[model samples]
Target: MRRKSKCVLGIEGTAWNLSAAIVDQSRVIASAESSYHPVEGGLHPRAAAQHHATHMEQVIHDVLAKGKKNNAKISAVAFSIGPGFGPCLRTVATAARALSLSMNVPLIGVNHCIAHIEIGRWLCNVADPVILYVSGANSQVLSYRNGKYRIFGETLDIGIGNALDKFGRYAGLQHPGGPKIEEIARKAKCYMPLPYVVKGMDFSFSGLTTAAKDALAHAPLEDVCHSFQETAFAMLVEVTERALAHTGKKDILLAGGVGANSRLMEMLNTMCQDRSAKFFAPDKAYMKDNGAMIAYTGLLMLESGAVLSVEDSAVRPNYRPDEVEVTWR
Candidate 1:
């Protein structure tokens, strides 16, 4: 008899978002997510983990219900097992283990960073491309070579999103600083001077952020936001352009929360146009941290015969994208 169709359920709780998604062979069937926003400072790992634990069950149930599937039909359970906060990663792992045991299905551990790249590739239908992964915690240029996604360039100090958030906090903006900064930057008519440091292919944002903060005392907020974004984005685009030239890749894929910024997208698009390369970025839903990417990537892993025993389902808080073996490709 022919085997039945398979569906994988993915859980994601790497940081502030608690998400669940169900995916079949072709696409994500359903996805649900709940995000925790700090009232004051940055995200607290313990508080974020507690939020995940509280909402994980409901989110999972909602996804399953939305997909119209029961536990009996699930072929595997996948969870992001690393490169995140310890408390949040552990919480998701525990939930994934329980679900795997209850359903008697295979368990898969996914690299959170790689999931972003895979989903972008899947969405754009690009075979091989230079990846610019930027988020609150990470900034790197990656390419697939020697059977793995290798990092060509990365942040030396702080990620771009974090830098923006810090600037926003200093400016008394809301929790997530990227969007607000982008909004105010639109009205900028003049640009201020800021530090632009790009060492070889790698870049540094700590110095630039400090300089931007200092400018806030004397310069208009709009000018500071504009200049800060321009300087930082120019550094990123420069590094990405260098990576493309070095790798001889004709396509560029932008993935991560920062990919949602219109100014960044415009800059990348212009650079790609000038360099005669293609640029691709997923929609907002897939660009940010979500369960759909996890579910889709997990489906690929499971199809490639990847199986994780409960004993080995422990989370890796410092998991790196290059450390994973790319069996699916």
Candidate 2:
């Protein structure tokens, strides 16, 4: 029988969601989350932070109770410390520090982007895979080399998720527009032309989204949405393909919230199949920002002797994944 490692308590509140989880090496013992939804438009930093502050207690309480019920003893207190909204990051950091002090355990400040990659690696059981991370504010093609997850390609403007949301709002769709666009695109009668800007490895989506929004004046909504998705996804796949060829890696991992898109998954899968490479993605639960990812990553970091003190546990809103040294890997 496989042995399970000690558990870690993790908290996440980077953007729209506030989540808490307890996880060990083998699986997530318990987890809970509360989401923040904007009333009229895209996510607001201050508003989202306030929502996290309001719901954090209940979320944390639920997860800890569940962890207690499972008899899981937390060895460390971990939280998403950077690459997120400043307000939200600070709120989570403060709570993490308190927990660390109360439990008399090590405090692990986890990089949010790295947490996504680690959870993807853990859930899908892939190693040394080229990664395509897509979310509301971040988009990058990365692969592990030396001691860092090197960024091979990235967006020059807004992320694909934000681009889709911008166009969605313009089309009178809801806040998180990717899923809605995907649903409507399936009913498209024909494709409409939109801007496709790929500058070597890096791609631009602001122009593409703008062009798609304008096409709504002349084309059906479904056609515009379908064309928009095709153009954007093609750009992403092109960059990912280039990364794969450059790295000479046979495995490709899709991570981040936007990886939840079925059409995007299909495009990447087709690319991997044509190239005779393997494609891996975690379950939908881990695709977005969640506490289990932070907790699992924290366990890895703690085991590797990467712990933080209260004074060093400040939040980092602009932390980059490549900035971290991959000690555990």
Cα TM-score per model: 0.97, 0.98
Candidate 1: list runs displaced more than 4 Å.
Answer: 1-5, 69-72
| lDDT tens digits by residue: candidate 1, 1-329 | 64556888889889989989988766778888889889898889999999999898889888878877544267899999888999999999999999999989999999999999999999889999999999999999999998799999999999899999999989989879999999999999899878889898899999999999999889999999999999999999999999999999999999999999999999999999999999999998888898978887898999898779999888999899999899989
TM-score of 1: 0.97
The number of the candidate with the highest TM-score is: 2
* lDDT for residue 6 in candidate 1, whole number 0-100: 86
Flag clash pairs in model 1. Answer: none
Which is the leading candidate under lDDT? Answer: 2
